[model samples]
Target: MNDFPWLSVLLVLPLLGAITVALLPRGRDALAKQTALGFAAATAVLGIVLAFRFDSGGPRFQFTQSTPWIEAFGVDFALGLDGVALTMVVLSVVLVPLVILASWRDAERSGGTGVPPKRSVKTYFALILALETMMIGVFAATDVFLFYVFFEAMLIPVYFIIGSYGGPQRSYAAVKFLLYSLFGGLVMLVSVLWLFPLSSRKVSEGGLGAATFSFEELSGMTIEPTTAKWLFLGFFLAFAIKAPLVPVHTWLPDLAQQAPPGALVLIVGVLDKVGTYGMLRFCLELFPGAAQWATPVVLGLAVLSIIYGAILAIGQVDLKRLVAYTSVSHFGFIVLGIFGMTYAGQSGAVLYMVNHGFSTAALFLLVGFLIVRRGSARIDAFGGVQKKAPVLAGLFLVAGLSGLSLPGLAPFVSEFMVLTGTFTQYRVAAVLAAVGIVLAAIYILWMYQRTMGGPATEQVSGLSDLSVREKVAVAPVIAVIVVLGFFPQPVLNVINPSVETTQTVLDRPGFRPQITGDVAENGARP
Candidate 1:
């Protein structure tokens, strides 16, 4: 059956609308807003359509769209999706439109002439849509080289948004963020270029080689153990910078603190996942031997980052910086689960990516509201906020519980599965990572206690509860946190098959990985 290229449409529909919005006449702020919302809503609808038709049983790169793009380099515009990709696509769709709504009230974009800022709402809205396009493409890309292009392209709009619409230090933060990402990307590109000869099957006329960017094609190649080791680190550094993994992770807190909350939410919640997802999908799969070889080193760093991030979070007085640091800690759990190399761990790692996005988005959004109300992100700036804003307190509590991985919360199941899977493999590492859970409670609860409870400060005396619009905006996200916590079966059902498939490929005879669990508990089994 030849249906349309639904996935390509999903990626481009938003950009087309963005271009349309961008070209509209100046001062047409209202039209720009309408166009952005419509475009975003359309993309979400397309994602929903794709989800229903997604085939979980087969290989993921389905509904694929491929064409020759760079013939000289052998790079093709190939794209496809599976359950893992679908989960990410759905998350992107849900979040981007909500971001549009969240940023709607700003005077520059809200069509409020009285307080309208200097930037054009049209360009701002167009950039947001463009971002959605790149984000979706990053997940859907099947070609390693194409994936790299989309991965690096995402920083452009985000840098603009941060520099144009953020705090006084926005430009500084934006430049730093871009430079860090570019540096990492350049490293990855070097590795990707070197990988071509090993990845391609076709020999060139001059005894050179044709490049192959397709994952399926590259999977057949063989490389020396020594060479694989160096290549692995090339890709690792790029993703680590984005994941903001410790030492390389310094750019995140600054970016979050200076950028607008909407920008913060998308950057951390969705864009950050591209890093960990890359590790799972690319690093572990494409370089299995190197992955096994580097496991000890990466895991050691993961454990250190877990404790270090939580410790730094505890010390932060700025609420936004605190949240950002917790992301560092929380992502460490994902890293631990990833290297565990078990079904439960990998499944839970994917789940961690999904649930973390939701909870972190909620936290950032709520904190943004607080800043709007009190004009500060400092923890000491607010006291007794719950008394004045019961609704806000309740929402923040939901987000925090998910972060702390409380039972029956969205993150609870994922965290439990991740830790449980790890116990079967790295018992000591699992125990230490569990301590990360305890640190989670400390920073999250203490942050809430300092910011939400105690006596009301003079500034907190008269604030109102969440507006109807705000309530409507956040209601579904909170509901999803609860809903997914209860019935993750729908997603789990889809994710397991694909995860097992990857596990099988990596479990090839060539790999001597330190696997755990019983003989009967093989990856192929349910």
Candidate 2:
């Protein structure tokens, strides 16, 4: 099982599905959807098997497969997984089938053709599978060039999905997204090119030092302070835009407003994490000194995003946009935890990435259900929905509580770890960042109160509760959130070694565990 090419199969399976869906006959929209779903489910099942079989105590990059691609340039078709990448791969694979199921009637809901057109259901689903391939590949690629290839490849399907299947303002939103992403990519390209020479070594036969784009090679090479700063900024700028911290985050609100709910799941729940993932994988790992140099500025921006996103979320008239803004705030905490550079903080950041996906996906899917019912996304249009749809209201409350980091919820554990870790290092920033938690409570409870509570409004009075399909789509996410909350130890055990290994590479000196003496005195009794 360990020797099997699981990562390769995981990466290729979706691409193969995309191709198969594309080849299906013109009128076979139903078959195409089924084919896509089948493939996604299979990929997800494989991911589960991979997780169960993963040797948590083994090598950092597991199931690594490498083959020379551009041997002259030292590029390779390399794929591997660490605990972080594995977790993300699982999240990506798991979400695809759910998105497919959730989007069954999305064309009709978006006022587009229900029957398949030339650019039809087949195309939509094919794009999704293609996107999944890119998502997994980006996380798994060990070669810098391969990672960049997957990174850029992702934008294509997403651009089409949003522009073609979204609301009236879809084109504008899609174009804006493309332009921002392209600009970031161009800047990062410079850094990638710069590294070819720096990471290259003396080739055999005394021709020249051949440039290599392998992460393993690059990570071992020495970079001067000035060069590292420039390179770090290049990667950081790209990630920040993707992460959409504070000023660069304008694209998300538009995307949330225009994109179909199913698309938003990938965009918010899985795809956007690429930014933070890049920060950890490339920025910190490759440019440790630059990371330390940029810490204060990064932390400041993170704090700003937290307060800014929370305040804007509170003020939103559109429910979808409100969810998007809340993500901005949540992302702030994730970044804060990552840059905190403590073991607990980094591990918490990874867990937060996972927990945020489920909670946010539930919120989007449930709210999408409401939009379909009332034909609106406005907070002012809804009131006393709980009276007519108690089940929906209850689900919304659960998701909202998870979003606000309520105790006994999945997000709470990660949030607590982040703050605890941050407090140990940067006390003032942690204190200020703590205010976001308060604001989170305000926005989440207030959103629930406004949208789900109060007297039954005319708009909501006739609205029906979740259908069976809707329940099926959302139930898994809700269950995962609750289950992971009480059993976070399993995830932490996997994440701790990776985080510690990263800290070791960076050589960051920090405090020993305060619980060590207490635990020893108590003789391991909890």
Candidate 3:
């Protein structure tokens, strides 16, 4: 199993699919869709196989592959996965096909209320496949340079998807998204370039020979404190923007409002996760002392995002924008868990990433369906939809409740673990962050009441129920949310080791765990 190039196959299959879909005859849109879904489904099945084969108790990074790429620069085309990366990989693969299924008619002229794509439907499907390939590559990469390549490559397809296929203001939204991301990427590139020289100096000073862009090699270097902090800030700034944390989060609402629901799922649900994921995988692991130094500020920003995002969500008139703001809020929690630097906190953060993907996907798809039926994104455009489309309303309620972290739902367990972990250390921050949960309930329930409750408006009185295709699209996501809610241990088991490994970095020299009062009795430190 180890000898198999599982990661390569996973990456290439979707790329091949993209090429194949793009090459299909112009009129064969149905064949293009089926081909894309087939490839996505096959890739998903392989992802499941890869997950089952992962040995939690074995090497930290399994199914490893390494070969020279830019030898003069000491970079490698390395790919591997820890438990965290494995889980993320599985999440990415699982969602792509669902997004494809839900978006079956998205590119068609009569598909929905939104404007049809300016390009061919084949182009739309092709872009999706290309995006899928980049998604897997970003998670699977074990080299810093390679990760950066994948990270920036993601923007290309997304840019085209939104600008060509989105709503009226899509061009503006896509440009804004691109500019924000490009600024962050440019800033981070300075730090990435600096790393080689820094690593070389540290290695030579210690009697070691050459430097490398390999993650493992850079992680082992003893960088100067000030330099490390600067490098950390460079990387952290980029991730915070990607995470769309508070101040940097302005682009998301615009993009969300304009993007097609299918692309939106991958953007907010899976792609945004890259930010928090980078924080966990690179920020803390590669620069522990600097990470600890930045935690107070990061946590402060996180709390602000949580409160600000929720407060804004309550006032949203657009359904897509409402869900987008909630995501900003949810991301705050994910960031909080990450910087909390406890085993439970980090583990829960990872789980939250996965759960958020499903919950948000469900909400967006359902909202997309509503907009298709009513020809409006405004909240007031709907009322008493439950009277006409009971099944759709019911599912929306489930997805909404999950967003609020209702008990017995997937997000609840992860949210609980995050608070439990953080409270033992930063009690005040945790408490402030908890307020976001109450605010979440408000926005979610109020949105539901407005759209799914009340008397049916004449406009919505004839709203149709979810089609068989729509149901097929969302059923798997809702099932995972419920099943994981009750039985999260399997995923947790996979995440725990990586969380522990990350936490250990904080215990080294120059770093300290700040465990408070009675909570310290449970364990010395998380």
Candidate 4:
């Protein structure tokens, strides 16, 4: 026990809370909700402490813990935190509490009575905490085996959340989500197992010749190009599905429409980003040549997602589904940034992950409020909401602007950096991708005008504004969006070093245009 096991504490704290919630007596739903909220808040407080203690200037991984789990297989129970992982952990912790608050009423509403259900309330919160632990584990695991375990474990809680608590089509959405995720997981597992033999060393050289699944160990070794490409595809396909890039993205709209708002936030806002994260952390780092070789194809898909998602969003009749489609478009930007293979591009992708969480969370929650009040998610159902719920309309506009990457908003900085960096490498892809922004603006503004700017209809009459609790839940997200928009240097500072290390691994010269504005002669940083 190295003084303080922060990583283990972060992982275990939620499980402990879930256990506590589970043990509460019958009819103690209120107590269970409070208990769950307390634990989530405590975990968030710990996350804040961890963030403060983290040495941004030091080694890539801090708070490391390693121990042999199975000696025969050379497997270790290991965990560590890098800037990237810390950023995600922080995002997860912060959002969990807000999600709890947002779901507090919805949980009761689900029961068809004005009061929360005994068993379902406890189970929902417990599942959320359990899910949090697995989420933290996914980003923090230092071993490939541990990462896979956490990755698969994440699906269970989310499945139950969607299946048990969703709307009329809940079962269909849950099954679809599970099947898609399971297929991807199986594909990636094959790749995980194959890497063991490739990673094995000669027994005579004081090495464990059987196998090893440690990220540190595997990253240090090299694989043949043909083998690396196959492995890369396995990992890439899994992530692309999770990222839910085009063609494979069908499940998202249905899931978003049927699932509860709180669950939608985590599914779309946090879990989906794991795909892009894996692409950067494993695919690019471990198979540099394969990544470069596949860049043209992947880049093409990314562009397709941008345009396809945007067009679909513009045409959507269901409000929740429209939000889901926009995420598809936003994810396209994140993937584009990653494959651009430049400092600005990678860093922007990471920042976009964080900013996207906040923006999308706001969008989903606000839209949920509308759906709850009007009892419908159709675009045609809402009209002139600003007259009755000006506060809600204002917040919706804020979220929409952020999603559109308007200047002086959080997303603009990262989105601009991504396009700038991508332009340096794949000029045509960057140019086509830029069209998504215009589409985004159209969809967001058009939706706002239809829902908030018109004459108040019967559906909108006498609707209420945000409550104190709702304000408490949404204010922090809006504040962060504004703060980060103006001052992105703090996140950029932490992100730059890790991104530089990644660029060094790829070690390829990014194409530099003859006309330069900000990028130095080295074509490194802007």
Which residue runs of candidate 1 sit more than 4 Å off their true CA positions? 107-118, 201-211, 515-526
For this target, which candidate reaches the highest lDDT against the unseen true structure?
Answer: 3
lDDT of 1 by residue, 130-189 (tens): 999999999999889999999999999988877777666777888999999999999999
Better of 1 and 4 by TM-score: 4
Q: Count residue pairs with overlapping backbones in model 1.
A: 1
List TM-score per model, in order. Answer: 0.94, 0.94, 0.98, 0.95
Give the better candidate number (1 or 3) by lDDT.
3
lDDT score, candidate 3: 0.91
Q: Candidate 4, which segments miss by more than 4 Å at Cα? A: 111-119, 202-210, 508-526
Error of 1 at 110 (Å): 12
Which lDDT values do the candidates have, in the order given? 0.83, 0.86, 0.91, 0.86
Question: How far off is residue 401 in model 1, in Å?
Answer: 1.2
lDDT of 3 by residue, 224-315 (tens): 89988999999999999999899999999999998888889999998999999999988998889999999999999999999999999999
* lDDT at residue 335 of model 2 (Cα atoms): 93
Clashing pairs in 1: 60-81
Candidate 2 residue-wise lDDT, 480-506, digit = tens: 999998999888777777787777767
